[model samples]
Target chain A: MTSSTERSERAGAPAFALPFRVGRALAFHELRERTRDRWVIVISALFALLASAVGLYGRSAEGNAAAITGPSLVTLASLFVPLVALALGYDAIVGERERNTLGLLLSMPVGRTEVIVGKFVGRALALCLAVGLGLGAAMLAAAPGEARTLAALLGPTMALGLAFVSVGLLVSTLVSRQSTAASVVVAIWFLFVFFYDLGLLAILVATEGAIGDELVSSLVVGNPTGLYRVSLLASLGGENALTDLGLDVSLPSASARGAIWCAWIFGPLALSAAALSRRALR
Target chain B: MQRLTLEDVAVRFGRIEALRGTSLELRAGEVFLLAGPNGAGKSTLIRVLLGLVAPTRGTLRVDGAPVRADRAFRARLGYLPESVAFSESSTGREVVSFFAAARGAPKKRIDEVLERVGLADARSRLVRGYSRGMRQRLGLAVALVAPCELLVLDEPTGGLDQDALTLLWSVLDEHRAAGCVVLLASHEIALLESRVDRLGLLARGQLVALGDPTSLRERAALPVRVKVAPRADADRDALVQALERVGTIAPVRGARALELDVQPSRLLELLDLDAAHRACIADLQIVPPPFDEVYRRLLSEAA
Candidate 1:
């Protein structure tokens, strides 16, 4: 029998020698799989073409002096950014578990943290590459002066995309099966992007301008997409343009600031990673 | 000897107690077969040991240290889940490599195990196209690639022909010779009888029996069959006393006149002695019940 001291030594055994390295290895494995998937390539091309068309249309309209305002572009980005995020992240966790690869990954020396974090990073990287392709296509589609617009919106757009992906990963872990998770994520998409905004509009109409100060600010802060839309508006319409447009374009709030916007994007991403890491494999 | 232990282990799914008050120890170089039918808690037990499921009420330890939170404990253990699945839509080679990377096996060893499992030629083909037997072989390859201290296999040979079964047994034999502790859970009793050194029979989350194969068969209390013809002044009472000393036996019934069922292997000595004295003038047969009867009888009686 082992002594108490020996028991303690074994109790304090280091997590593993290769959890992080293996996580990175898994990340690369995910990348290889993602890159080889015909769907990813197809979606990448589609997003690129779509972003390119939007960019070209914006540039042509600017030349003709019939352009959509900077705030309008923010609204436009809001429409599609969450779609991409939800589509990719929703299946990230549940699909692996459904396909039975999650068990294989969990059986390794690595902890649950590694598997979740690694997959998040891997999926995020795939999204980045896909969005980058879209941005490249946007660049080619730009006419003369729209390169500045693309540059200004690029980082913020990618950050918003990452935030959505994190949310999807979180939902994936929370649910059991792939089909159920996918369905819930889609419902979440409808609620957040479509219905929630519509409800907010109803609230705005009832409250009118009297309650706009505190309530409008709180609502915008609570919604990451609204915050991102506001940020993108500022990038397009000059810094003080949101203040000038009043609630018509975006709300003004203490937490609606740019730093808070960054936090909104990173918060869920961090939480999803944490949840995935800390939760045990079923 | 290194020991793997579970203390007051319990697993529950909502209100259902999949495993309750389950605790056992496995030692290095011992082939411990966990025999149970479906829903007998064998799968749940194996999952807990593999670190896939946390025990609701107790702790899991390796060498006397808690492994519930020990990630490295997994590295020392190799697992073959009941139904193996792979991502990347990969060929057999890629699937094996993924497991090798997870287990920290040497790059060269991956190829060796693939060849050992008879998947060397099919290594380049996508696993999506593999047959059930080939996939099972691949699963075995994954479990064998690493130098794990403990190997936990759930139905390792669930789908295999006799030839494929031989290949798996051979691989297990190699692991045995190398002194690896193997904990296998299977409903296939005939296969496990020869493969495992000890058999653990579980029913409704309780360990009803655990011992070497012969000991288990003996403890099962099911009579072993023996036949003999009637003899003149044959000390029938003495024969009955001698057989009763060995184990419980049935009365003389059916065609052969005097037929007794005793301990599986113990009857041989009595028969040998009787033959030496020129007693058994007919034929002999040893019939054993299928292993499931051990659980069927106990579970039913308990209920």
Candidate 2:
């Protein structure tokens, strides 16, 4: 029952505390909304179904079952992670704007950066949880020794989700309409998950070895999906499918791969914050 | 906050100017209303004050100390947008609590605000289940949940029913009584005329008139109307001749009556005529200039 005067005085208490509290409140609200919409459950179920099928299929096939399953899981995750991440984040900001809630939310004692970061944190957590549960279930169902490889694959899968979700947020900020943001998100997914590697391979074929292995390696490391595949494949000592395609895909060291993943996760998020700051919330 | 001032503030969206060098001040304990036609920049001005839109020129000051509308500055401000929306899946209580926590208000204040907005009974229901009026009430609950030095509401009465509108006015009164600066943009001029302390009429991004209702009416100097019904056997021609000398007279439809539009200065003379013609007039009623009339006149003048 603190009086409003007492509460008003607290406004000057600490700058850090207010943003942190506001960010946490916004994040929790986002998580609650997603949970109520069954987004977490649906995505988790989809991942579990797909991951189990991929795991069982890889176990029946080839040399070193664990190594095979690990790369196989990474491949599955690279495709699904971007799609799911984009779906979760495509309308994050634009949807609010469309619903006419962005202005009210912005009017609160919350920073624009806090809004973007809070949403990212919330969706990232949901993504990690859903993917973790699905992959965890798959790992448990795997043969005893293969569980380690699946476990090792889980972190990179979540990182890949973070990277793509950040990209989705950037799209949400740039577009004014929710439908446009959604369309752009789909385009981004297609470009990254499918067309990117196809275009790279097309370049190799088109150039006829004019593009050196060093340059192709740099290109591979540039895309989040490519980095996820190379880093996990290199760490698990599994041969890459791209290498098998006669591309001579040399993977960067684990640390460089990790650093690039960090950049992927944060770069678009920074841009989104900048875009939101410049936006007229009305 | 004793005084919040917008010093010659102008906001431009690309080549189009939304607000043009408009200066205004809102003092504590006063309910200031912004009235304007569509595209008159009422909403834009509100956004600028909320810090959602930065002014392309000029400054915003709180109590004579210039400040940016950052989170710290907005900390003491409460706002309800023209259309208040929340997640359909969230319950009334959850929505209120989310905003309350974001504003750093105590948790107990959530229920208090819900009760204040008459949503306590519906607190557990999802927003999707709430009626539009209920949704507006929930929006008001969120805005009022935290204590604020300045409360800004845009079109707050849009979806509100009579009961909710009455509740809103009462809550606004409480805020004003508590020395909160209540700034609202609304088209409910007639309803708000008596309640608001001052009115700013914006036409084409300019404040055409700024004063309380009485002063605004005086400034507009629009004519007042007097409706008169003549006796059955009275000489209507003679009554019209006397009324015409005082003011312009027009026939009242479907009645043996005449409507007189007279300037305020001539109202006493018209009333004296009505008194002299009481034998011929069965009824006479004087209608003062309404707030709507003043608003229309001011806007037309500015246009």
Candidate 3:
């Protein structure tokens, strides 16, 4: 039976031409290989568990039983998104170079651009899967309360998580060593999650709140994590009340905002690809 | 036809000239061996061919077309790098498939190559568990599966047992038999001497010597030394004349050593006949200078 199947397969030529297949195949292979990491699985599961616990606790505290509101979902994302994105992307390109496999990959009928883009995409998909699984648990914890609200929040949050992943990939290309890549990625994470807000608060204190709404909006856009927070908040609830805050919180039109976020996503990818091609193999 | 050519190809890492105005060509189906000491720009030359490093000057072409990083250009090469490491998490089979898939390989080719490299049973084993030799074989397997017209391998047999070496040789033979051109960079002269058809010696980033193995061996100009006891009235002039007739000969006085330049192929012929000649010979040793010596002398001349 196997022999017959082999014969039939041999008789049927490959449908896709080699290059496109290679790009997709490499992407898929990485997706599977990285998914097998026990740490990734454990941390993702634990994060999901924590999200469930938080959602449940929040639901109990509120009198009305809605799955999760804009603030709670944003809170959950703010806590865990950077951790996952940094972990996934920190070792992407540098790890391959250190392993001596970069030459092997580059020598084949594959483009450095394809490799850079494909790996980032593949790893982004893996991060999405893990985040999706965790978010599913978080949604369940918001169950019987605000399931609709929790569902509403997932779309924009994942997109924001994806942007963080791209930034991680960019840093990986710049750093040669895996440990160094990890350090820089973790540092970026700290700046976004903890430092950006603190620094903003300090700036507000120093200027006697001279930084008005306009500067605040630009600063939020510059901070990847802060942009994610505002975008997620806006996506989940139609009430754009977050825009009125003293933190320079004006959301641009969706199209303009989408372009800004897309740049955040693809801008790093393009820059990293250039850096990778120009890198000396040594 | 010149299947591969490098014209005045020069490369530099900062001020260090890794390859300097190197040029050579290999006809299809011929095995060209690159031999040089460490830091002689052999790796640089290979990188130029693979398009890994652009030359500081000169041009390289494969199959009469310029090589760039475009997909169509990369489609034509199979490279087996030295000390190729796999992702610590990938199985041997998956690693091969990943590379093959990167080139859009058919599934059957993957299994065929794995079996060809003698890693069929260990297909499921993670690459981290592989021994150095096993990784080398797996690397060979990856290089083989691609539909490449030319195989550019750098030090393909750096770390292998005799059995593994034999397998690698057979793999090379298979490719050559299939009319594939192979350009190998290596320092293992003995194994490559019998295997490769043409040899190119790269010294300090220049192509100093290039020819068949027989031609290289002949070019060494090894000298044969003979110590003859002086017979009271032996025809010393005739003796010198007789040795000269056999080949180029000169005399060193203190030990009465007569040196005749001879190729290794003609050493035995001279030995058998010199014994028959009535010259009183005290001692004789056919001293063939080391390959390294010939290589260095050639580079010095080129410089």
Per residue, candidate 3 scores C-alpha lDDT tens digits across A86-189 of 77777778887787777777776667788887888788888888778877786787647576667666666677777888888899899889999988987888
Model 1: what TM-score?
Answer: 0.82
- Candidate 3: where is the Cα deviation over 4 Å? A1-19, A62-70, A234-248, A280-282, B62-69, B223-293, B296-303
Compared with the true structure, what per-residue lDDT tens digits does model 1 show for residues B196-264?
888777888887777887776566666666655546556655655555665665665444355666656
Tens-digit lDDT track of model 3 for B68-124: 545555566789887788877889989988877676567788889999889999999
Model 2 spans with C-alpha error above 4 angstroms: A1-19, A38-41, A56-68, A237-247, B274-276
Model 2 has a clash total of 0
How would you encode candidate 1's per-residue C-alpha lDDT over A159-273 as one tens digit per residue? Answer: 7777777788888887888888778877877887788778887887787756665677668656777777766666566667677666454545444466666676567667766
TM-score of 2: 0.94
Q: Pick the candidate with the highest DockQ.
A: 2
**What's the distance in Å from true for residue B199, model 2?**
0.4
Q: In model 1, how large is the Cα lDDT of residue B83?
A: 74
- What is the Å distance of residue B118 in model 2 from its true position? 1.5
lDDT, each prediction:
0.71, 0.85, 0.75
Q: Per-model i-RMS in Å?
A: 5.6, 4.3, 7.2
Provide the TM-score for each candidate, comma-separated: 0.82, 0.94, 0.84
Model 2 alpha-carbon miss at residue B182, Å: 0.6
